[model samples]
Target: MAGSNFVSEIFLFPLSGKIAPILAMATEIKAEPAMVLAGVLLSLVAIYIASKAGGEFFNWLGFPPVLGELVGGVVIGISALNLVIFPENGVDSSASIIVKMLELTAGLAPDAAEVTFQAQSEVLEVLAEIGVIILLFEIGLESNIKDLMQVGVQSLVVATVGVTLPFVAGTAGMMGIFHVSAVPAIFAGAALTATSIGITSRVLTEINRLNTKEGQIILGAAVIDDVMGIIILAVVASLAKTGEVDIINAVYLIVSASVFLVGAVLLGRFFNDTFIFFAEKFKTRGRAVIPALTIALFMSYVGAAIHLEAILGAFAAGLVLDNLHETEVGRELEKLILPISDVLVPIFFVTVGAKTNLGVLNPAVPANREGLVIAIFLIVVAIVGKVACGFSVFGLGNVNRLAIGVGMVPRGEVGLVFAAVGSASGALSPALDVAIILMVIITTFLAPPLLRVVFGEGEPEAEEVPETSG
Candidate 1:
C-alpha cells in the first residue's frame, strides 16, 4: 500500500541545500501558517510545470506522456535542477528551489526553513499518494469486471510466476554471487517482485489495449502482483527486524488481503445499485461523480485499514461500479472523473521521478562501483523475471504472450516502496539499495516504449461500445 504512511516512512532525510543562506537574523523567524502555504503553492507551480513540459515533450517524441512527466520530475528534482526535493538523509533543505523562493519572498527564516520545507514536502507526498489512488480508481473504472473474471485464472498464473521467479532468482543470485547476507538478499528479491500496475495500465490505455485479452490479463495480473507484493513486503520487513520470518503475521496479511479484495468485488453488485440510487436522487451538480468518488475513497480507506494498499480498495471500488457503464450515471461519472484525473495523476508520476536519487549511479563514488555491478545483475533479473510471465498464460488462443511479459516489466513506485522499506530497516546495504533503485528506473522507463513496439505504434482501432439499456 503506497499510502501516506509509506510516504512519511520513506522521506526520513531532508533535502540537500542548493541555495546559499541569505539571512542571518538574530531573531529566528518562525514559519507562520502563511509561510507554509506559500511554500506549498511554490511546490505546486514546480510540479505542474514539470508535468506539462515533460508530458508535452514526450508526446512529441512518440513515447508515453507519463514517461515525459517522470523525466520532467527528474530534471527538476534532486537529480537535476533541484527545483523540488524531498527530505532524505544527508541533504540540505536549502537545495529546494521552493524553499529558497519562500525564503526570499516570504521572509522564511533559515532556522524554520527545514520545518517549512518538511511541511511542504509532506503535503506533496500526500497529494502524490492521493494521485496514485485516483489513478487506480480510474483504471478500475475503465476495466470490465466480467472481462477480468474471464481471465482470472491466467492472471493468477502470471502473477504467481512473476512473483516467484523474481523473488527466487534475485534472492539466490544475491546470496550465491554477491555473498550478500540472507535478509538483505531476501529484501532485494522482494523488491524485484513488484510490477507497477499504474505505469503499465497507463501505457495500455495509451495504446488502447486496456480491454484487449492481453491487456485484461496484464491488468488482472498486476493487481494480483500487488497483493502478493504486500504479503512479501510484510514477510521481509519482519525478517529485517528479527532474523526470522513471522509466519502468523504473514498469514494474516495474506488472508486479510484476499478477503478484502474478494469481498469488495462480490459486494460491488450491491454497491452499483446503491451508487445509482444516490446519484439519481441528488439532482445537484457532481451527483454522479461525487457518489462515485465517495465509494472510491471509502474502498481505499477499507484497503488501508486492512493493511493492504489503499489503491486496491479504490481499484476494487472501480470494479464494483463497472456495471454502471450501461447507465447514464456511469457515463457521466467517467466524463467527470477525467478532468480530476488529469490534474492528480501527473503528480504521482512526477513525484516518483523526483524522489528517485540518481546520485547512486555515479561511478566516481568508490562505494557506488560495486553497487553498479550489482545493479546490472538486478536489472537483468528484474526485466527477465517479469517478462517471463507472458508464457504462463493457458487456454487462451492467439494471445500476445510477449506483450504480457513486457507489460509486467516496469517496477515504478512499487519497487521504490520495497527499496525504501528495506533501506529503512537496515536490511539492505547501500550498494544493494542503489542496485534496486537503478533496476526500478531502467525497467520503468524501458517498458512503455517496449510495450508500444510489441503492441504496434499504429493508431488504435476504435473501441467497441458497451451495450446500454434505458
Candidate 2:
C-alpha cells in the first residue's frame, strides 16, 4: 500500500505543482499560450511603471531615462517584484516539465533529454536575436542624419580615440596580468570598444549641452563609434569561428561598410526627393508615411544580408530620411516606433539581467576566482583607457575636458551586446561573463552623477537661439 501510495504521489506531482504554483507564486510559468498572454499583460504594466520610475530617477540625477530603464531592469531582476520569474525548478524546468508531460501522456520516451534541452535553448536564443534585430530597427528610426553629419568630423575623432585607447588598454591589461590567451584578450578588448551613446546623450541634454557644438559632436561620434564597433565584432566573430584572421576579408568588411554608408546617403537623398514629389502630387491621407517605414525595414534586411549589423542599416535608413521634406511622415513613424520599442526593448534588458549569474564571483570556484581577478584588471583598464581619450579632443577651444571624459564613460547597450555575444559564443567563461555585465552596469550607472559633478548642474536650462529672420 505504501508503494502504491508513492506511485500515486508521483503521478499527482504535475497537477499539484501546476495548480499550487498558479495560486502561490502567481508569477512564474512557461511561455505557453496562456502564459504568453500573461507575459504580454505583465510586460505592458512593467514598462509603464519602469518608464515613469526611470524618468523620475534620471531627472533627479540629471541623466537620461534610458539609464534609469536599464537600472530599473537590474533592480527588478535582482529584486522580488515577482513579475518575470525564472522557472521554479531550474533553468531547464520548463523543458523538464514538458518532457514529463509527454512521458505521462505517451508512456514512452521519444528522444534523449540532452537533445531536447539543446533544441529548446536554440529556440530561446533565436528569439532573443530577433528581439535585438527589432531593437536596431527602432534605433534607426530615431536617428537623424543631418544632425549626425553636422557633428560628424569631431565625433569621428572622438570615437576613434575612444575605440583605440580602450582596445589597447583592455587587451594589454588582460594579456599581461591574467595571462589569458591572446584571442580571448582581444575579445575582451573588443568588448570595451563600445560606448553607451544613450547615457552620454542624456547627460548632454540634462546639462543643456545637447544642442551645443560639443554635444552634437559627441552624438555624431557615438553613432560612428557604434558602426565601427559592429564591424570589429563581425571581424572578431569570423576570426574566432575560423581560427584565421583574413586581412583581405577584414579590409573588405571595412570597405563594404564605408561603401554602404555612402550609398545609404545617396539613396536617402534620392528617396526623400522622390517621396516629397509623390506626397505633394497625391496628397494621400495616411499612405504618405508608410514608405519611410517600408524603406527602413528593407534597408535593415539588406544590412543583415551583407554581413553588417542590422542597426547600422537602420541608422542609415534614418539618416536618409532625416532632413527630408516629409516632417509629418517622420513624426508619425517616430510615434509608431516608440510604442513598439517600449514593449520589446525591455525584454532584451530583462533577459540580459536574467542571464547574469552573480554566484560566478564566488571564490570557491577556482576558475571563477581567476575570472574575478581578470574582471578587476579589465575594469581598471576600461576606466583609465577612456579617461586617456579626453586629451584627444582637438580643435575645440577651452572645452570642458572633464565633460568629454565623463561622456565617454557609459558602455550602454553596445557593451552588453558584446558581452552577451561573447557569453553565447562560449568565448567567455561564466564568471568572466558576469564580470563583463557588471562592468556594463557600473559604467552606465556612474555616467549621470559623474557628468553632474564635472559639468556642474541640476539639469542645465536650454539656451536661446538667436532669431535668424531679418
Candidate 3:
C-alpha cells in the first residue's frame, strides 16, 4: 500500500513544472479508468519537452543537438538523477516504468503495468522506426543514384576500407579483450560502420571548403559508407533474430540488400514521372503531397517484405524522387516532407537517450566498471576506424588528412539506429547496450568541436599528393 502511494505521487504529478497547479491536483485524484491515459500523456509531453530543450542547449554549446537530447534522457532517466523512472527491468524497481504505473492502480496489479508498457513500447517503436525511415530518406534526397557512383574510385575505396577496418577491430576487440559473446560483438562492430555526413559536411560548409577535393571525398565516402552500414545492419539484425549466422542466409541478405537499393533507384525513376503526372492533375483538388509520402511509406513496407530493412525502402523511395521542385505540386511535396521529418525525428532520438542506462558507467560498481572499460575501447575503435579513411585516398592534394578523418568520426543518428535495432532484436545484453550508447554519445560529442579546430581559419593546408590507383 505504501509503494502504491509512492508510485501515485510520482506519476500523478508533472516532473518539472510544465503543468498548472490546478491541473496537477485534478489529475492526481482522477478516477481509476482515466489514470493510465493521464500517465501516458504525461510521459509523452515530458519526454518531448526534455528532448527539445536538450537539443537546443547542445546546439548552443557548439555540439550536435542530438547529444543534448541524449543528455536530457539521462538526466530524467533512472541512470542519472532518477528524476523519472523509466525502468530497464520491471522486477527491479530501479528500471520499470510499468511497475511505477502499477503503483497508481489501487490493486497494485503488475498486469496493468505490463499491458500498458507493451502497448506504449509498440507505439513508440512504430513512431521511432518511422522517424529513422524519414532520416534515411532525407539523406537520400541529398543526391541522385549517380552520386553514389560519382564518388571517385578513391572515395569508394576509402568507404570500403573504412567500414572493413572497424568491423574487424570491433569484433576482435569485443571477443578478445572484453570476453564478450560473438553476437553482441558483431552488433558493436556493425554500429561503427557509418560516418555521420551531417556532422562532417557541416564543418566543411562552415569553412567554405565543401567543394574541396578532400571535402568531396569525405562526402562521397560518407554516402557509400551509409549504404554499407545499412546493409551490414540488415545482416547483423537477421543474425541476432535467428540466433545463428548461416552462411547462405548472410549471402542472401547481401544480395537482397544490394538489389533492393539498386533496383529501387532504377524503378523509382519511372514511378517518379507517373507520380508527378498525377500530382499535377490533382494539384487543384488538394491531393498534392500524397503521392510522395505514399511512395515512401509503400517502399518502406516493400523493404520489410523482402527481408531488407524498412529504412532501405525509404531510402529507395527518396532516390526515386526527381527533386519535386519543378512543378507546383512537386514544390509543395518537398515542403510537406521536411516539417513531418522534423517532428518525428526528435522523438526517436529522445527515446534512445532516455533508454541509455548511465549507471552502467560507474567505476565504483564492479560490473559497470567493466562496462566503462569496454565503452572506452569501443570509442577508440570507432574513432580510429573512420579516421583511417583519410589515408585511403591515393592522391592527396591540399587535403588535410586529419580533418577528413576527424570529420568521419561522428556516428550520430545512424549509430543510434544500429543500437536501437540490437536492443529491439533482443540481441544486446544490458552491459553491451550501455557500452554502445556511451560510444554513440562520445562520438557524437567529439566530432563537431574537433572539426572546427582541425579546419579552423588560417590553418596551413597540406599540398595535394598526385593520384595513384591503389
In model 3, which runs have C-alpha deviations exceeding 4 angstroms? 1-40, 78-111, 152-155, 174-191, 194-245, 284-286, 394-404, 412-434, 448-470
lDDT of 2 by residue, 34-148 (tens): 3333334444455457656865787676565656665565554433343333432135423333334434553323433323333333343344445555565554444455655
In model 2, state the lDDT of residue 381: 67
Residue pairs clashing, model 2? none
Ranking by TM-score: 1, 3, 2
Q: Give the per-residue lDDT digits (tens) of candidate 1, residues 69-175.
A: 98988987889888778875246677888888877887888788876776667678889989989999999999988788888999999999999999999999999
Model 2, which residues run further than 4 Å from truth? 1-35, 57-63, 78-82, 85-90, 93-147, 198-208, 280-289, 325-368, 429-431, 458-470
lDDT of 2: 0.60
Clash count, one per candidate: 13, 0, 8
Worst 10 residues of 1 by lDDT: 13-22
Please identify model 1 stretches exceeding 4 Å from their true place. Answer: 1-30, 459-470
lDDT for predicted candidate 3 compared with the true structure:
0.67
Cα displacement (angstroms), candidate 1, residue 315, comes to: 0.4
State model 1's lDDT: 0.85
Clashes of 1: 13
Q: Arrange candidates by lDDT, highest first: which order? A: 1, 3, 2
Candidate 1: lDDT of 360? 88
